[model samples]
Target: MRKISRGGARQGPGWFARRWTAFWMRFSGPGPVGKLASRLAAWLAPPHMDQISLAYLNRRGYIDATATIYHSDLRLGQNVYLGPGVLVVETKGGGPISLGDRAEIHMHVLFETGRGGYMEIGPETGIHPGCQLKAYVKPIIIGRGVMIAANVALYSYDHGLAPDISICDQPLVAKGPITIQDDAWIGTGAVILSGVTIGEGAVVGAGAVVTKDIPAGGIAAGNPARIIKYRNELKNADKINE
Candidate 1:
């Protein structure tokens, strides 16, 4: 038997873990240390530190802010960072969207699901701002260490209409589960449709609309994403557009 390639498995120097650790370290600093760090972080290049604090509070192993939780029966693990205005909804769903520890969710992201459907996000993953994730009747599993860029839309189920049947009249059915394997990078503005699986280590190009499953280590692009290259094995390695 041959060993299957675990391309999407989280490897390297634990970049995300390091950042999370640093956040805690700063918080545990001297009496005035945490505030100073926040000021400095704000002064530094990038987004504000206040946003980071809210995110850290929402999902951190150090503190469980369960009582302030706006939703009941929603599972949030330790060290999971959820920024301000992060909304998780089970409006018509029977289950919940369980988030793993150390997951970073940016501000203004919307998560909604329908009956018996679920959306599960793994640990140390970054869910960027303005992402809309809707699961209807089919579960969506986002693997560990996944990097989802801003404004990404992911739907695990879609409406179906046969030639003989009217789409508006017939009950909506889920195409299938949408599985985003570990270590995958979903570029900014990328849209992943129903029944699509982004394989391990796969890279989805920005503004691309994925209509099907992308193979492991694959780099896909275009309106309806098409395999353009493979990070693990490909002849045109140097020709990688990215």
Candidate 2:
């Protein structure tokens, strides 16, 4: 028996050569030489189970090779994709987290569920890189076709501030669930708080802290996000002037 060190000359060179030969042989037309090369490659390195082939991967979702998923109840629909470096976890025996069909979670995203909390992402939703969704005591529901830009944060609970208690020691509280309705667009670095509903077809400006509910078809911005304009209203006004 022989021991092989990590990234050693023997292993590295041999591994690369085998892979290159395998690729060349596989691409070449079927023949005795190709068959022999393919068999050798198979013996050297067997194919690992991919997203479509693995039952666990399919059940949870199409997770990237580099993604980290912790022990949690996850229900994912067909064609859901999780990019590299994504993290999904459930702490304190929380409820199941679900993602609908064709949901795409990009690189470095995180989904965390706290005690008795759950999170749901609707069909065709695309979450960009570095986004986080934390459900501490309530649900965080994102509706269909929602586009969440990079560095967004959605929190379904807030830390309570009591006079006698430290911030860290205080319990987390939530007035209600955080909901982002269908076809909404959340700009980069937006922070959505608990009890807030970003209505259907609404637009949230970049770096906005949403603390209140936005009306349907509204455009909101700034801290404690206020409705700067209504989409339908603006359209109607433009039509009248024209």
Candidate 3:
């Protein structure tokens, strides 16, 4: 038999390496040794036992295995679901990122709050695939029962575009706070800028660029997102301001 090269040996055999990688991936965040550590932590740190479990425990709760959560101060509430390839990243910034209970995020979704970061997402919010939310300056609050469609980007901050300082080099800068009120439905590819509040039960049309506040129970669409119609309807069939 020919001599096995060091490089080839280091990489390992194809099948075994793949299997080993998969197994190691399972134990990556908390690691396989967490089985014992988590148990000990739960014992030693008796108070707030849930904290010990969350810090080290890894369990199957119908969440897609491909999802990735990277952060020390990550808070995932009860029964929250994540689909495949969801990336929740908290890098550089030092603060807790809180996700409310029962928030359903679909495939390829990104929730990134790092480098002057904060995120507070409310309960029962359904975020479809390809949604990206980056809150860098204050906080981004997504209220309860909201539905965010695919390819939607809610950015609470932006970089300064002046020629003196390159945007790539500069850090995230917030115009103001971005808040999505309860029961709002943001359509596909909608972009909600900073310092705006989407009122309760408001509808943001697809491909709209929202720059101002959307009134409660209002329907808005298009670039600069004009409020075209009121959501309420009269018994006689006229559009009523809600």
lDDT of 2: 0.78
Give one digit per residue, the lDDT tens place, for model 3 in 73-169.
7677765656557788886763567777777777788988866668888888889889998878767888999999999998888777777887688
Q: Compared with the true structure, what per-residue lDDT tens digits does model 2 show for residues 119-205? A: 989998999989999998899999999999999999999989899998779998998999999999999999999999989999999
Q: Identify the candidate with maximal lDDT.
A: 2
Ten-residue region with minimum lDDT total, candidate 1: 59-68
- Which candidate has the highest TM-score of all? 2
In order, what lDDT does every prediction score? 0.72, 0.78, 0.72
Instruction: Order candidates by TM-score, high to low.
Output: 2, 3, 1
Ranking by lDDT: 2, 3, 1
Collision pairs in model 1: 59-79, 59-80, 60-79, 60-80, 61-78, 61-79, 79-102, 93-114
Per-candidate TM vs. native? 0.70, 0.73, 0.71
Give the poorly placed runs of model 3, Cα more than 4 Å off.
1-61, 234-242
- The C-alpha RMSD of each candidate to the native structure, in angstroms, is 12.7, 12.1, 13.2
